[model samples]
Target: MFKEIIFKEDAINKPEKGRLPTSIAVLCGVTILALCTLLVGALISTQRHSEGLQQVVSSMLNKSGVENPVTAVLLNFRSYDTLLEIAVLLIVAIVMLPQATVSKSLSLIRVQQSADPGLIMSSLLRFLAPTLIIMGGYMLWTGAYSPGGAFQAGALIAGAGILIFTNVQYQVNMQSFAFRALLSIGLCIFILSGFAVALQTGQFLEYPQKYASAIILFIETAATVSIATTLLLLYLAVAGTQEEFNHDA
Candidate 1:
């Protein structure tokens, strides 16, 4: 106990490697200044380049096959970037998949304990889940014509799924083939669509203009489901490991 106290005293006496508050403040100020400078420069450069592209994109919008400019760019003009984005998300979901095996890792008793939702919470979740699901579906359908898209739709559905999963007594079975399939279906759809289009057009994801709208809709629909499932898995993985929640305060 004496040695521990002395060690703590020594630690308290140490001045964080001689980094004074003023020095630390200056370091942070410099970093902020540098970041602001870079950001300003990028904004200026982008503005200079983007001025001409507005009319160009507007002229080509009819050919891009989507009423929404953002969707056109993401799903049609530069789809490979979105493909890579989905692939990265899939990798993260796969890594977190094991933690979502609540049926295997958490005992039935603890699982029940962790799902200790009160009457109010259960009622709220019941209301929110259906509302969110409806909103997600609307958003997914509107992406081709409006600001809403797959990511936003997926996020909304994930929120619903999280509420339902955390507040309810149902345990997620990660071992189920359907669960894994849902987690990976987005990337698989993207890849298969890319290859199918490539076989016809000699370039991956280069959808023929006539079929672009349908193709984007199909891809976005599958991605929406996968995105929701993957995000739900992510939350489950973290929530399952927190044993303290099973105990009362």
Candidate 2:
């Protein structure tokens, strides 16, 4: 009698397959409201004076020294915003790494039978990774005078790290004390340097005189390493392996 009662209770609690009528009605209402809002916004933005805003933006972008105006606006004129953006990104990465279980240990194991890549693919990826890394560094170095900046360099560095992660099987000390220290070091440097700049020049992130280039370079290099490691770790956490993958050239 107890077993039958339990079974009946379980059946009662089980969800039905189709959407509830109330849910369907709510979804339809939301969709209709969203469409109405979008239409209204579109009409409002198309007013006669809108082109004036466009012209002003064009004039400002043209005056910016960097070649790519969007890049200039993002990394130079709006740098404080960019700094907060990067800090948020770093926080999100740290939060995403799983630690509730010993799942990270599983990532240290190889699943596929290891086979050496043929001469062509191996040579190709080897050459490509370094080339991209160098190009990324160059981009960061010239960012103040040219189009590219830390974001672009960091992206390329992460791509190279991905290549290295895939092309070699090795144990990573993801949870090591040293690794944690290294992970936080980049943010520390960025914040400390910004504060120093503020103290010396009364402007946050004002590259100090005679060391401006060096400061930017240091920040970019650290950013590259931090972003690369974080991305590689995230991939390992998700895909579950420290084994060399053959996804690259």
Q: Whose TM-score is greatest here?
A: 1
lDDT of 2 by residue, 1-249 (tens): 022233664586664454457877799899999999999999999866656444654566544444455555554456577667767767866886656333333333233336565677568677998898999888777775667877778778777766655654433445545555555666777778888878887998765555654665676567666666666667766765422222320
- Candidate 1 per-residue C-alpha lDDT over 1-249 given as tens digits, one digit per residue, 9 for 90 to 100: 022233764565643453457877799899999999999998988745556667877788898889998898899988999999999999999887663323344333224555568998889988999999999999999998999999999999999988877765555566566777888899999999999999889998999889989999999999999999989888978887333433331
Can you tell me which runs of candidate 2 are displaced by over 4 Å? 1-37, 40-45, 48-72, 98-121, 208-214, 242-249
- Candidate 1 versus the native: TM-score? 0.77
Cα deviation of 203 in candidate 2 (Å)? 3.8
The lowest-lDDT stretch of 10 consecutive residues in candidate 1 is 101-110
In model 1, the runs with Cα more than 4 Å from the true position are: 1-21, 34-52, 99-116, 241-249
TM-score computed on alpha carbons, candidate 2: 0.62
Give me the candidate number with maximum lDDT. Answer: 1
Candidate 2 lDDT: 0.63
